[model samples]
Target: MIPAEDRAEAGRPPARVRHRRVFYVPGYDPRSPRTYFLLFSRELRKFAALHGITARMRAGKEDPATSWHVTADWPGGPVKTTVDCLSWHEIAVRDFAVPKWRVALLSLRVLWDAVWTGTVWRMLRLNWKFGIFSLYPWGMALLYALAALGLVAACLTLAGAVGLPRLAGLAPAALGLYGLLRLTEILDRRFFVWYLINDWIFTWRHRTRRDPEADARFESFARRVADAAEDPSLDEVLVIGHSSGSFVSISIVARARELMREVEGRPRLALMTVGGNTPIAVAGRQPSPARAAMQALVTDGGMLWVDYFAPQDVLNFPWLEPVAAFRLDLGGKPPRNPSVRSARFREIFSEERYAEMAYRFYELHFQFLRANDRHGEYEFYRFLAGPEPLESVTREPG
Candidate 1:
């Protein structure tokens, strides 16, 4: 966090009437935090133009110790947004584009866990929920399997052409496999099957058993949240989570609140989960830490929680009651549910642009953060930098 006195020196316009500090937790993306920095820079400028709001953004220096900060000036406010991208890309990079043998072994492990734990049925339900988007993983698995088989066949053909004996063909097959793997690496930059599997593996590890590294990371993130919540200079502390981050955000907020008890006079804390895939991750799991965290959040009365989903994106479950899905007991009373809001992407994009990217499921899932083609409701920029409080903004539909 930047000190109030140093904010002006950091190139932001002096002081403002209100201050909003946003902590963004991105989903299973392996990209650097710089990716988000650029995205915010582009979208904030467009959002300001589209809404006719006088907004100016100053890109701050990236610091791993304090996280990436972007200062935005809007009506009645200059919001300081920090992106806490809790990505294990370092772990993902180790095996994401590795050889076919490694990926095959990992996929088998994921499938076995899903089957043994009855999560396959849960996956089926998720597929039914998200339609084609949910089926993408299965499709990617099949595509990779078929591609490997084709490579094997091509290797055998090359072996025959060279008049090699039976066992001699194995070497050519190995070389062909390596080539195919490299090809998939090039292709996966656009179509992220391998990268998706990396995400699934992380989710699977959390679902089945505790991952020590991931647990430590979450705890560290929660501590950071607690620190921000306790900051006296901040007016509001907003935690925004997208996609797989929704579940992680829930856990972080829950843990942060527990730590917040130590700090008196904490700032207003709010949670906004967009394009959330919590249900998919928690599916078919019994009483677990994730469920416990969800229970804690839904039952907590202090903070406001809003969940945003769009029907157009098959990656997220829209209008789903997370408390009910987690099967948490509220002590025989009605529980407070998160404000489930519909995010209309079609309204956000023009007809031409919508048609162009409508079938691109992954792109649609990210509409939550991108600059809207036309202003309707649910402006991402306003939610972060607007004058209205987040709780009040979500109270009225856009």
Candidate 2:
């Protein structure tokens, strides 16, 4: 048992808290928000059963259209948390709605610029695994193009062999090209070649800060976050960013901090990024908005930042320091805010469970947001619905 005086020595949050507001910014996913709602509900039940706690989801909120309130009665105390999905689902839908030809051309431009500007080589130098991941979409795109061109060539050759005029070959050539494109579409249902191309297209726009729609959406998130921080009822405001959303969340939180600076008695602000690939957007020697956001967050020094990583998750840059990778300008002083820590899946899960999860790459990436089967330091459920404050639990023992 611990004494009250010992709580501070144990690394409690700077302030006492009865409630927390969690704003979850998901990655570039087009799925409905209801999917996330159900996933969280199911995971919360498992988390409660595993920890022997009473965590009840009262109901879903219609005002925000994707929010839930949960109450957890833990060993520490009864705490309430409101989890809001700051969704850009509609924007993703718009991306998918784009004409196929335009998406192809735009994605081609992203690849050409990466190659022309030597970004792909730079990426390879930084981390070969992720550099290869970056190349996959482009590689698949080129393969499709080559297949289409080869089909046209074959059709022309057959026409010549049959004593048909060159002009007559155009008809069969067009038809063959259409059939090949259709076949590729069918194949893409499995490979997701075009889907990945669109995803990278979105990432490229964000990297350059040229997407006005994204900028406008970021502004909306900033205002919402700033309003939440000023709410007197809330004791903590935690912004969660995962995968592609990590960079977006950083921009929103940084902008929101500036908006909330003049307010009085604001809630404790904090940022937590899980399986983040922030360097993908914010890196490089070029000055961009994403890079600027990284710099601003550090200079402001108003929020506690925590980054969680896993080496097994190839989607994220594991076993690397992000600040150094992003090449952030910090006046030659080591930034003290973000406390990077491992999720320790190997230490927490049994061998059988780990083996079952191995080779299923997407499952491993999503593990950061799932419940643990055994005790661990960084369980996603415990981080969100558990009794401890984000900062208090993530802070290092001194």
The prediction achieving the highest lDDT against the true structure is 2
Q: Put down candidate 1 lDDT per residue, 311-385, tens digits, no spaces.
A: 878788887676555567777644554777887777778899788777887887888998888876688987777
Give me the runs in candidate 1 sitting further than 4 Å from their true place. 1-17, 59-88, 95-100, 126-132, 150-164, 262-264
The residue pairs in collision within model 2 are none
Mind giving the per-residue lDDT tens digits that candidate 2 earns over 84-171?
8888877788998897879988886888766765667767887888778767767887888898788778777888889986567778
- Candidate 2's TM-score reads 0.90
Report lDDT per candidate. 0.71, 0.76
Q: Give TM per candidate.
A: 0.86, 0.90
| Residue 352, candidate 1: C-alpha displacement in angstroms | 2.1
